[model samples]
Target chain A: MPEITYRDAVQKAIADEMRLDDSIVFFGEDVAKAGGVFKVTPGIYEEFGAERVRDTPISEQAIIGTALGAAITGLRPIAELMFADFIPVAMDQIVNQVAKYRFMSGGQFTVPLTIRAAQGGGGGFGTQHSQCAESWLMNFPGLKVVAPATPLDMYSLLRAAIRDDNPVVVLEHKYLYTLKGEVPADASPGSIGEAKVVREGADLTVVALQLMLHRALEVADKLADEGINLEVIDLRAVAPLDSETILRSVMKTNRLLMVEESPRQGGWGASVASMIADRGIYHLDAPIKRVNMENSLIAYSPVLEDEIIPNAGKIEKAVRDLLAED
Target chain B: MTTDSIARLDRDARLKALNTMTTIRLAEEEIQNLFMANLVRGTTHLAIGQEACSAGVAQALRPGDSMTCTYRGHGHALALGMTLRAMMAEMMGKASGACKGRGGSMHMTDQSIGLLGANAIVGAQLPIAMGAALTAQIKGSGAIAVVFFGDGATNIGVFHESLNMASVWKLPVLFICENNLYGEYSPVRATTPIDDLAERAAAYGMPGVIVDGQDIEAVYSATLAAAERARAGDGPSLLELKTYRYRGHSRADTGPYRAPGELDEWLKRDPIDLLLGRMIAAGEIDQAEYDEMRGAIEKAVVEAIEWAQAEPFPELEAADDYVYYPG
Candidate 1:
């Protein structure tokens, strides 16, 4: 076992995968010489060389489209968009071309590509550079979206996404990059559409994704002192949602609290809550509770940002309120 | 560049060009009838007048070379040697189609014949074609990618991006702009300031050649030279073929843009008819042979129609089948 940060886990996964498969190449603004804006791809250029670890121009559309082409032509490419908010420039490639190619081509081609971008608002990067758009991508049918909240999960999920035969969007929360945790040395590549239960409890189940997963776990620990059993599940992948695991947790705990960092409207929490309401409604003893950011652009100021996003206190309060219901 | 060499193509190549154009024309004509009869669904952009561009460019390409086309792609697919039966079946939404009926008329693709795919989105194929060419260049496959687009694609930002990238990277690609004078009922003059679409390539520092698209010999010569340059790793070239489409932009168009006299004048310069006359005057074939070729083409067209009509529709559950790998 090794204590590694989430950023190091991602770097290790990319390095390991690139070592195993020569076809796995990386490119983005400052990803090569500068080691990526977030340093997730640090020192990769020295080991892999400039050809494989490429530095591209600031054209996001070209970055995505070229990666897509390379992916379809037998190379596994991991493209880094500097920030998640800048993904709009490349949306045509991601949404129209990459997402639909496999389905539109009748499965003749596979887009084995990973688009990694730093998401979430906590670094005072303002509205343009911050914000989580995982829900917007979830609206598309042919894409797989993933967000790993911990070091071990990041390592395993990155490996899994690289091996997938379809396009995968890995959203890295900028706030969780340096967060450290114990990661197993020989952790196997994990499945895409499965939820990992971080903490098991009997009273209430808290379903959280990305950065909010850690918050949920913190809330669960805090509520444990009050004799309230709180379970926390990290939804690692979003598109091929692990509804079964979430519903089974609801069936056991009989209470649910969904958490996400995206806007409250059409967020990952809304989808999770809807899934539970549709299939696991009868199993629930109380209505599903959701904890998400307010439906507004993330502000730059620390106080305003904190006011907009959901926190551990909010999760703990939401869980308490759900438990208080009849 | 010599006229003597240009005239030495012999009778077979000439007849083949004529035959290819005639096949495309007849197939599209049959498609029009089928569409009118409610047998074919979705939009069909018939390339009736632009046959020489497809036939000549397709002839210039080697068997393993690749092609990407715009939504007006029936000609490209047919010219690339896809069986009329498969194409018609695709247009009719039958399982026997090239894309298993998933890609209707606009998106037909046959990888076996090097037809990468016909994209419905304008200028979208530019980057994809450049990528294909890059793949060919990297693999040292000697396979060049030819992208066929209409005059309207010149205005799209992706077109410029692709051209610039191709020029900078020196990718083995030939960008063929079929300047049919209109972009969905709107004339090119209304939108474009420059009359010559080939001139746009000047921005990328690539050689741009404008050819008489009605003349199959002219198109063949220009494309052959461009293909040679690409194969030689001299970078991509822009070949703008000045042509027109006899039919409307799509099936729903009544084609009222052109006057009756204009239609009649353009019809007189039909590529198929011009090639047939040249072959006849050169003693390439007798009237009996010509009539026999015509009769055979008609029979093939009818058989293709019958095959499409008799083919089975795709299964309902299979809609999601090809979206990803089954395994």
Candidate 2:
């Protein structure tokens, strides 16, 4: 096992894949000389040289569209849009062209493009920079979405996304970049739709994602001290969800709670709630609970941002309330 | 009168260009008739008055070169040597069409012929074209990529972004703006400030040229020059072909926005007539030879329509396929 920060794992995953496949190309604003705005792609330009690691203009449309063309033709392009909040600038290319090409070309083509962007609500990136837009993409059928909660997951999930011949979105949370974990050299998380049970328990299933998974585990530790065991499930992949794992957990504990940083409306949490309501409701003794970012623009102040989004205390309160009810 | 530049392609190539332009005209006319008869289920955007641009650009490209176009691109797909049967079937939404019946008139693509895909969005294909050029540049494939968009598409942000990207990276792409005077409903005079769209290329540090798109030889020569530059790694160029569309933008548009005599003025400069007039004047073909060529083109159009009419629809079971390559 090797310890690597989530950021280093991403750079390693890209380097490993690029080493194996020459068709892989990386580009975005300052992805080259600046080594990415978050320093996630440092030293890659020196290793791969100018031809493979390109620095593009601030045009999100061209970035996504150029990658779309390259992907469908022959190359596998990893495009970075510095922030998830800027996705709307290239939404036409992402939602209309990139997502529709394969289906519209009638299976004649595939856009093997991976667009990476950092998303979360904690940072003082304010309104323009802090947005988790994976929910908007989840509605589209042609795209595969994944958010890794650990360095190991980030490495394996990205490998799976690049290798898969589809338009996959690899969402990196800015808050989780510095978090480090021991990653096995041979770990392969398999596909973009698989889930992992981070902490198993029989009391209540607490499904979480991204940084919230860490928060749920901390709450699990605290709740354990109080004789309230919490089963923490990390939903590594957001789209093409691993419903079987979620359903099994709900059936066993007869209690389910989901937490996310996206706004409640039209977010991943709403979708999870809808899924359980559709199929897993009969297995749950208590009503399903979702702890999500409040439906408002994330405040510029760090204190206000924390209050709007979920924390360990909120998770504990929600779980205790669910257990305290009938 | 056969412009010496196009005549340089020789009599055989000149006839090929003339024949393609005529076939496109006949095909579009048939499409119009089909729409009237309630036969075609897809929306039709006739390139009736803009044939020379498509034919000329297609003629300049090598075998492996890639191309994309706007919704009004039946002429482009046909010029790139996509089978008439496949194109017509695609227009009619049949399984035997160019894209296996998935793409209709606004989205026809024939990969074997290097026709990437025709887009419905105004400037959506520009970045894709640049992407193709990026691939070619990286692989040293010696293949140039070209995108044929309308005058209106030049206003979209992607157009400027892609042009800048292609310019800085020196991507082997030719941004051909088929400036057909009117962009759907609004006239060019009413929309863009500059009369010539080519000059905008200067802002991106690329060579910009304007040609009388109604003149097939001028288009062929300018596109050949641009393609040569792109193939030689001189980067992308913008060519504004001042052409016109004789009909309304789409099948449903009657085009009342044009001046009362504007339609007649542009019709006189019909690209097919210009090419044919040149051929007759150059002693390449007399009236009898002209009649024979017309007959051949008409026959081809009829056969394509017949083939399309008999083709089957795509299987419904495979609707979800190809979204992820299934691999």
Candidate 3:
């Protein structure tokens, strides 16, 4: 099926997991032989040479503490952070050493480590290289985060965040890296806190992620030609937040909305509207609208970056103001 | 005596470096009497007079080499062999700990003896021991790592981005530093402007040296000549050592900004009384077999603090076991 390009499905999910894990490797700043400044890692440093695709030193905390010290001594690495707004120059190697080294070494270390980074907003690289840093990494809990809107979930969630043992992150979306799709040359990966629902419709739900899940599927295909359908979903991994498929699509679309692109203060759509108002608030009939972006600063000017980011006409006006409050 | 591992320190490697510097000075005096009987909680940082830079860089590494120190690492986790009842059951937090108590005592890990932890942060274990020496220079695994910091993590920034990416990837790694001249109390000439922190390893071109860190054969001959120039791939070196920290950066910091006879001048270089006065003047032990090998290492640090204070403290639903990686 090879129709590729979410930057060739993140360079075929990191050259198909460094050709089935020769314990993975890869590094950052111009990921080797000067390929990735968003060239996504061209020819993986001429097919994994320079000792597994090397090239580092722009040292974001020694590229995430040498990918949490080569994932606790065995080596899985990956690293890259060319810009997830330089994750606060490596927030103490991703919140105190790759999320507290396997719970403060209690499990004696497992950090298979992946990292990647690029993040969202639609280029204009303003406000510290555009924004959406998956709500500054879903507030930490040993970091998983994901974010791929498609070239098949960026080749199955970056081959499930480089075969997840733990420290994941990924992000991508510098405007869905050339978008495209088809994928399947062994695509697989679905569950890092699942949430696909892609289109369906009972008249509301929405949710969104990465380029606001393609502007909530172009506002659910132009509100399914006025019959007002909607549904959407696509979240893909904001720290295991499937929230049981957005509370079973808000108990048959009783109207949720969210949509984001960062900044409704502490966003991943305010933890999916505080987990659907703490346990799908009587299976939502309204009050969860979100639409986000204005916490300010994006501004490079594609009309002040499309007047504060959201779009598909602000998810069809927050899905017609939550289907006119049901 | 320059790197034939300091004329191969024999006499049972100088009485196993005076029984690993008297089991790291009786496990930092039983982790300062288990933090004065409150049986250890938060802050500890001891390295009591540095124990010959963790018994001379864990006697020049070896067993699939790996390390990463600081939080004044209980003398590099008892010079890399770990045990003393899994570091006093992870400084008494228990459940048979070397991390079963979820890494107490500034996160000490054992990783079956490679001790891949002990980082309370300062210089963040030199980019995770330069990423475990770039995983032994990409799994040709002649393994080498060694980190240890201090001299206030040489004014950190991931210690100059882990020594400029471990000397532009010659990797393997050794870095040491233990220049305990005081980072936690502010002494290395008022937060170091350089009275030699091994000349910041010449802005990362490696080979820095400066040892005598209370000697353990001059830090096992400059960490066995920088771990054989990082297992012959020739990279990373910065040794430093120049030790001291008889205490005070944590738990009862009697350091009172020491200047008054600077703790009797580093307690007159007491690295286990200068290797038991050079194994009792080279006649090899005599103060009655050095008081029966320090009364059997203080009866094995008082039976590893009464078997880590009769163990068991972890089961609060195992505090949601190791935060992640369960699958």
The candidate that wins on TM-score is 2
Q: Which ten residues in a row have the lowest lDDT in candidate 1 chain A?
A: A101-110
Which lDDT value does model 2 have at A299? 86
Model 1 residue runs over 4 Å out of place are: B1-8
lDDT of 2 by residue, B59-82 (tens): 988998999899898999999998
| Structure candidate 3, residue pairs in collision | none
Q: Write the per-residue lDDT of candidate 2 for residues A1-66, one digit (tens) a residue.
A: 789999999999999999999999999999998899999999999999999899999999999999
Residue range A1-326, candidate 3, lDDT tens digits: 66877888888788888988898888888888978888888888898888888888788998888779889888888888887888888988899889889988888789999888887776777888887788887888988888878888878888888899998888888888887879777668656778788888897888887788887887788778888887788888888788888888889988887878877888888877887788879877778878887687688878888889888887787678778885
In model 3 chain A, the worst 10-residue window by lDDT is: A184-193
- Evaluate every candidate with DockQ and list the scores: 0.51, 0.78, 0.34
Interface RMSD for every prediction, one decimal?
Answer: 1.9, 1.1, 10.4
Query: For candidate 3, what is the DockQ?
Result: 0.34
TM-score for all models, in order of appearance: 0.95, 0.97, 0.43
Q: Rank the candidates by DockQ, best first.
A: 2, 1, 3
Supply candidate 2's per-residue lDDT for A110. 75
